[model samples]
Target: MNDQDITLSRRRLLGSVGAAGATGLALGGATGALAHSAAQEEAPTALRSVGATAVPFHGRHQAGITTPLQAHAHLAAFDLAPGAGRKEAAALLRRWSRTAGELMEGRPAEDDTAVGRDAGPCSLTVTFGFGRGFFGRTGLRDRMPEALAPLPRFTADALDPDRSDGDLWIQIGADDGLVAFQALRALQQQAGDAARLRWQMTGFNRTPGATAQPMSQRNLMGQVDGTNNPKPSEPDFDERIFVPGDGSPAWMAHGSYAVVRRIRMLLDPWERLPRGQQEKVIGRRKGDGAPLTGGTETTPVDLEKRGKDGTVVIPANAHVRVSAPETNGGAAMLRRSFSYHDGFREDGAPDAGLLFVAWQADPLRGFVPVQRKLDSGDALSAFIRHEASALFAVPGGPGAGEYVGERLLDG
Candidate 1:
């Protein structure tokens, strides 16, 4: 490669090394040698191109939700420290917003962490949200939307309270793992004495340009997931996913509700099922994610179609059938999720699943009804476990010189 290409390759190598360090991956002789050789060669376009991809922190809505999914992400929740109330929370958010905006533009925060310097912004996005309990902690209960109420217990939930909810939530995403980690670490440091981490979850999706061309991402279960997610191009997308300004609480205008779930896939059982049986469970083709009785991934599912034997083509209890908006009074949510693999469990099974994050204007109409149906008898529920859950009200993107939740926290 030429001199310029070599410089880019070296940056890619450094980025890889930073990722290894972030993940606590020890670099031995063979790995180090391999990394050196790989660095000499041209890096993938995705790696080299990502450093130039930047998402603005100030917008009509937060960046992470609508921005295409990044390859790496960190989801964290924090509880306010004792004696830290609305004033403290507001100041913290201000600090965070300033830091997020700077970092997202490939600039270091006032307190620099060199973790992401060599890397471009990689479309870094930092989104903030408030949990239901946050209102009580900040003495702003009257500002809390009824939609922010705790989700009703689901039959399939084996929730860990310790990792469930908190007063504040932060979502950091970037194509590069180190960049994402750096942002997470910086935010945690910025929290100072105002808040302490309650729980955090790391997740990932396919890197942009990893495949030959763009396509939908697949979850751990190997299904092309999120095919039905609402698109910005859709006429009613905003209405369906964002709270209207006319809603009761003025502070929440243009905001959205996020339902986050740590779902553990029962891989052993799920993998053992025959492909046909697996298709029956999800009601979609494994290879292309098309509806079983459909033409393409986006083709409307014909739930009524049946086989010669007079059985439903997409099983009655199949996931797609149960969760389809049509079956739920046209309810919809914009699903943007990541796959997580946290190594093996004590029982030797893989502890991995989808980090399901769905955004909607209202959870009661968006997630609750659909999930309740799934709880009753969605075929796919048998192969997955809901281990932790949280719901947060994510306000609209901050305007210039403002931080997220400024209205509720300062008004």
Candidate 2:
């Protein structure tokens, strides 16, 4: 049949099957239609995957402040097999990258890509960071140096041998809840028989009141969340995010450190509190995320003095008190957090909280110290609990098709 006639027939067939199944029906006839159908069939399943990487864009707070989306973050620990060297790991990673690209572009696999299993909708963005022991080894010695790598200030003392001392992290995002599990499955499959590569996954989501705005907007809790956050798209971001000096390796510079915390919110009890009491605890209004001692949402908080009656306006132990710039001598960390509303608990109640994510040049000096300070019996502790946490050293973008940290790890 002529091209037009074939097209007409295919359209008729597709119409008969309805849009949902039309592609499959059309594939049964014309060669071109068959090819298209195969392509559609090969497309990755609609699954959730994790996305873990350093913050790249400027003005991140704007997106966090404006969006209503919630984020859930989790951390998984893994190790590599003894004989599976870097080359094997690289091969696996390259395959993963290929699959991820296809999935992102809506392509599916014709056969199982890894573990003899077919590709699916869920994919992950896996990023690597070097540890002291990784650089100490001969296989990677020439590639990495202690001075050039991220200090192992955040890792736990009980190290996993099979897993590289180096860090591998993944961030998965989706409109569906299954994405996280799917991404984990993919990672497990890719690891294969190798027991040396150990990993941990920490999940976080945006808060209920979180908007995709910058500083001064209120999140679901009615208190302004990031009023004190550093402004992106400015020269300061360059200085803060990028490591200074020609002495540093080219790959190492321009990257920032990532600190992740899986905080559990006590929503039920938090909601039970009277609105005024809640406002006092958060030091802001719930609807707007504004400060209790308010001006506009973006207005800087006045933590210097007490209220009219001499009682502390913003309580000394409030979250804002610990995280605020004024109280901490202008200490800062880039926060790109999200709220999460996972499925209900066994009791049929929601298990929800914030996926607290932050980035900085120095985790020890920036995030850990700040977190330690905030942990000091703050008013925010009343409604939030830190269930899981981890720190990752994220490299900057790659140049000319090279992935970030490719050279340092000999990938």
Candidate 3:
């Protein structure tokens, strides 16, 4: 593989964002609303150069972590088959890495199904990671990064073990629906007998160049998400997201940790509340994502502002207030989530919610503290349930002629 394979073009990215608003999905950035319907349109025409855009596969960091959210995604995990270990895992990664590189560049495999043969790259990305048990399964326990610690149980957790973690994880995203599906199917085949599928969740976001400009990335509950997301330009963004070379685990240098959760929104009950009460719950103006205290979307939330009744304008238990970095010792995570709808349930309610994927240098400093705060009293907790959870040590992007995880598996 070429070292130059993974760099994203800044000019191309900017063009995707129209002046008026953003496309529906801009992952790893400010939140925007995802429009869901009774059915997903296969490939709803092309927009600008969406189909021609390509995200390089080889870089210092994995692509999907900071790459803009694609319109469609497939999040799945796999457990190693019996007797599979380091040797087998390495070979699997080799095949996966090669195929991922080709597919991401809009090339197809020999066994390809031709699902997106003419769709071009569509900004596709296929990211790989290792869960806690992955080390033990591969006999690389000693090389495992301590950052893969188990997540503490939260009050709102009603976790289903079957749908949670796995020995390995894969996140596939693309601007085009068919291209995303093609990547998912291609990678699953590459797993071969070395790994068995555990759980899979399909998600979608607003397509690039969808709106006149970029609009809000709204969730199923109809709220603007990602208002306070940390930007790459932030001085401490890389320090907080990617592990430096001086990090403890030698193999994980430049890598980051990921916390994946399937949070189901209680939409029926939430929709019952009037829009005003809903805004009060989140402490933001639903229309523009501005703080209730006033100003635009980027306005600083007034935590100290009080109403006429001497109560804080943003409720003490409001999600925005509770999850604020100031309130949680400056703990922050780059949240790149995709909205999911698994159709209606047997109970006649929609099984729709978010596939929340958060990345940080260390879980202890990023997701843990903030989530702990939310666990205690984030008003949004009332409307969401943590159904599945996982923690993975997503190693840094591979160097030239190397596959993902080459350092750990070969070191």
lDDT of each: 0.85, 0.49, 0.83
lDDT by residue for model 3 over 62-122, one digit each (tens)?
8898887789999999999999999999999999999888887666665877788555577
Count of backbone clashes for each model? 0, 81, 18
- Residue 398's lDDT within candidate 3 is 87
Candidate 2 similarity to native, TM-score: 0.64
Mind giving the per-residue lDDT tens digits that candidate 2 earns over 1-411? 786885564344333333322343212223323333344435322121111111111221111221222243334444445566566556654554444343322233223333212222221233344444433332665655333344343222232334223335554443223444444456556656643335444444432224464334334454546656677655676455444434245455556666656566767788788988887776766667667677766666777657889887888776777777566655678776656566688876566666666767666556766665666656777677665555555555455345435645553
lDDT of candidate 2? Answer: 0.49
The CA lDDT at 8 in model 2 is 67
Q: Which ranking of candidates, highest lDDT first?
A: 1, 3, 2
**Which pairs of residues have clashing backbones in candidate 1?**
none
Candidate 1 residue lDDT tens string, 73-153: 999999999999999999999999998987886666888686776676777899999998889989998888999888999
Model 3 ranges with Cα > 4 A deviation: 1-48
TM-score ranking from best to worst? 1, 3, 2
lDDT of 1 at 15: 56
Candidate 2 residue 261 Cα shift, in angstroms, is 1.9
